[model samples]
Target: MMSVRDRLEEVFERLEKRASDERVYPKVYWAAARAAADAADERRRAGVTLGPLDGALVSVKDLLDVKGEPTLAGSRIFRDRVPAGEDADVVRRLRQAGAVIIGKTNMVEFAFSGIGLNPHFGTPGNAIDPKRIPGGSSSGAGVAVAEGTSDISIGSDTGGSVRIPAAFNGVVGFKPTAHRISLKGAFPLSYSLDSLGPLGRSVADCIAADAVMAGYGALVSTPYPLSGLRVGVPRGRLFSQTEALVADAFEASLRRLSALGARVSDCDLEDLLEQMREATSRASIASVEAAAIHSDWIETRAAEIDPRVQKWIALRLATTAADYIRMMRKRDELTRAMDRRLAPFDVVALPTIPIVAPLMAPLIADEKLYNKTDTLVLRNTTPINQFDLTAISLPIPDVPLPVGLMLVARHDQDRRLFEIALSVESALPH
Candidate 1:
């Protein structure tokens, strides 16, 4: 077996030789990672394992603080902000579990856009194809794991930040129920929707990192029995406009699950989805909260901020307190409504994104295309956040490009969702 030190050395070599030229990782924790690797190696030799994450290489999104460094959250505006006094809760937990903290990955500015373009810090290209966009705001986290520079990468999923990148990079991304992992020391996007998540090469990889970060203690989740498991499919708005390839891959995965004795049926969520959309017609919950978070800088530093992000947040500055409050109330009522509606199924499955990683050139050149694509990319996964559900995106096997099979369950059903994912993951073709 290779020593942790040896693996760390190889990771360094890969990163040094990577085509993205360190764009995927803006900051590499060389000294700290070396110390952690050495410590893990000693523990391994002493037959003293800290936990499942012992010796694992982990990368965190730039949105997370790593003690003494400012949490940039992929923006240039905060470059001179006060450094953090402590590590983010998830970072502290990963260290406690003996995982080697590799570095900080790039992300969308303030984690606002799903298209993963970062004009401030060059966006990390898709791991599968360099010319394609790497989905984000968790862009670098996804690329790092996909490119094997990190075994597991941590990201925040406000509205498919983690899953979008994972889907584009062909990896597993798990978004736990909101608040399952502490967000202390992480920069805020949408206080209501932001949730810390992990992206990795497999369901088990995510499971290990999730267990550690959520403070669940060291444990392996047993796969839920697939036979007779009820799987629901929300076949309306969420399913509309999906690229043929993504839709076909999703349907094929469903058939494979059915063959494994799982029950699959369509569950209509259009009415509930319509109601949620209507409630937020004025402004999304994320934009309104983000506007408040960056209120001081939105106008004074408008030119410094990403125009796409600024436009959305600036528009929300006009959101009446009454409108925001009413939307929140409606969202709560609808969350419960969806929960009751989903009670019959173990999980609801959908494509994580409707399309593959798009070429970066066209999106960069055309503002209209960028906006349309951003909305479409986030369309499928955003609803899960609005309803406060736990979800995971599993890479479908044998696809030319990456396509994610997203599984969702009611809030607080995180472990159940993982167990189901494990079963579905094993049954899918590799």
Candidate 2:
């Protein structure tokens, strides 16, 4: 049996090996891990009680400000920028909980896409299938956790960046209610939609990380029980395009939940989807806010950006002020509609990604297919951001490729959602 110290050292060694490959990220800072481990050991020796994550090794998405590491956000344009003076708020919380910040992980440049391609820095390999994508812009962060290089990974989720990879890589990924966790030092993607969250191997692991990041006390021990829970299955377009494996796995999951005594019912919230599309038509919060954050850089370093990313930014820049205002107004309307529709169920359930992770080559070659798959991949997850709901993507068993079963709850019901998720997790086939 290995001690926590020994285990963490092993993780650090793995980080070194992965970083040395130079395929995951442009650079890694090992000194930070050493310093954190020493501090953790000192605290333990002094007889100080620690949090559940004490001494656990963790990875931060490169988009985040990790002191002394450049906030690349997966772009070469900011490669020369100086290191951060302070850790992002989430990083600070992890430190306070005694987790070691091992190294920065790669991401899609500026987190512009769900596909997780970084032509500049090689994309992280998916743990389940090397040839497949690891999912982005939290690409490498998910890999770090799935590959056992870290106990937890802090990544940003704006339109499923965190959940997409976690699902594709067969791990647990959680996105808390919007604004539940502070985003003080993380790079901006979409100020309105961007959220900081974690990827881990188990629901318990995700819950532990979330508690610390949210500044909430330790998670209360909640037994998995589904005696009276109402879980809505959003039928129709939401589940229309799921692959055979994913569809079968989801149906089996519902049967298991039924055996566990959950009240599973079909729900049609087609209105929610319509509202979301309408809200984002003129100028999405993601486009408008990200454009604002990168306007200066885009103007000066346009040529330095990835062609796909540059085009995305260009589209944002083309939007008029009226478009932005219209988008915001419609966003508010959509939020209210979602809240009303979701009120009947404890949590709504859906597949995390419509299709399994596609081959990397085709996605890169055909921009149309890439855009199409990207929208479908994020369709279920993005609605939570629009409604400011708390959600979690738990792995569905027996699926050919990793596919996640997502559960969503109303704002401020994060803990409740987690409790429900535990039951759902157990109900899925092993």
Candidate 3:
């Protein structure tokens, strides 16, 4: 095995070798990362290891506060904000597990968009194709893992921010159940829906990182048996706009699982989806919560905000407290309904995003096109957040442009979701 120190050096060299515009990390902790790597290397020589995450190289989203640094959350407005006095909860946990913290990765402004473009900090392009958009708001975290700059990267997922990038970059991203990990010291986009997650080279990587962040210490999942496992495919509007390639890949995955003795079946939830839509018709929980978080800035420094993100936040300012309350209550009811609907399946599987990542240029040039594309990109993964379910996106093997096979489990069943994903990942043709 390579020494942790040597691995860190190689990652730093690879990052330094990249073109400036192609850089993934905006803020790097060179001294801290080096110190952590040395300590881990010393432990290895002494025949002692902290845990599974020990010596792992990790990158965090810019939204997470590292003591003495301002949390940018990928926006220019926070450039001069007061620096944090302590590391975010997740960052602290990562350090305690002997993980080497590399630095902060770029993301969409305010973590409000799924397109991953940051006008202030240049977007990190797709790992597979430089011209394509890397999925976001966890954009750089995805690229860092895919390109081997980080062994695993932490990201926030309110509406597929983590999974979208993981899918685009051909990596594994796991979003734990909401509130599974403390959000202390992290910038808030949606108090109601925001979740911290990990994107890594493989499912095991995510599993280890997740356990550390959740304060579970060293943890592992026993792969669920695929034989007789019930896999539900929610085939409805969520599957309607899937590109032919994505559709083909998803169907093939289902076939493979079935051949392995898994019971794969289509599960319809159109009526439940309709109810969720109606519940949030007044305003989305994310947007409404975001409106509150940015109420001051939206009123005074609206021009300083990303126009794309600001527009949506501004629109939600009109959501009266009554409407917000009504939405939340209804959402609570719908969450229960969704859980009941999902009870029959071991896991619900779907295409993470209905289409592969699109070229970045056109979307950036046309504002209207950008909005349309963003909506499409977020459509599939956002529902999991709304319903409070735990989900993971695994890259479909051998795809030209990466597509994700998303496996969703009932709320708070994060560990089980990982176990199921492990089985599915192993069964897939590598």
TM-scores of the models, in the given order?
0.99, 0.95, 0.98
| Candidate 1 residue-wise lDDT at 374 | 97
lDDT of 3 by residue, 207-326 (tens): 999999999998868999999999999899999888999999999999999999999988898998898888887788899999999988886888887898999998898889998888
- Model 1, residue 312: distance off in Å is 1.2
lDDT pick, better of 1 and 3: 1
lDDT of candidate 3 at residue 365, scale 0 to 100: 94
Candidate 1 lDDT, 1-430, residue by residue in tens: 9999999999988777864656999899988999999999999999999998999999999999999988899889999999999999999999999999999999999999999989898988899998999998999999999999999999999999999999999999999999879999889999999999999999999999999998986867899999999999999888888899999999999999999899999999999999999999989999999999999998889999999888889888989999999999999999999999999999999999999899999999999999999999999999999999999999999999999999999989998899999999999987
Query: Which parts of model 3 are misplaced by more than 4 Å?
Result: none
Q: What would the C-alpha RMSD of candidate 3 be, to one decimal place?
A: 1.0
lDDT tens digits, residues 260-295, model 2? 788999888887788778778776678778888888
Alpha carbon lDDT of each predicted model: 0.93, 0.82, 0.92
Global Cα lDDT for candidate 1: 0.93
lDDT of 2 at 248: 80
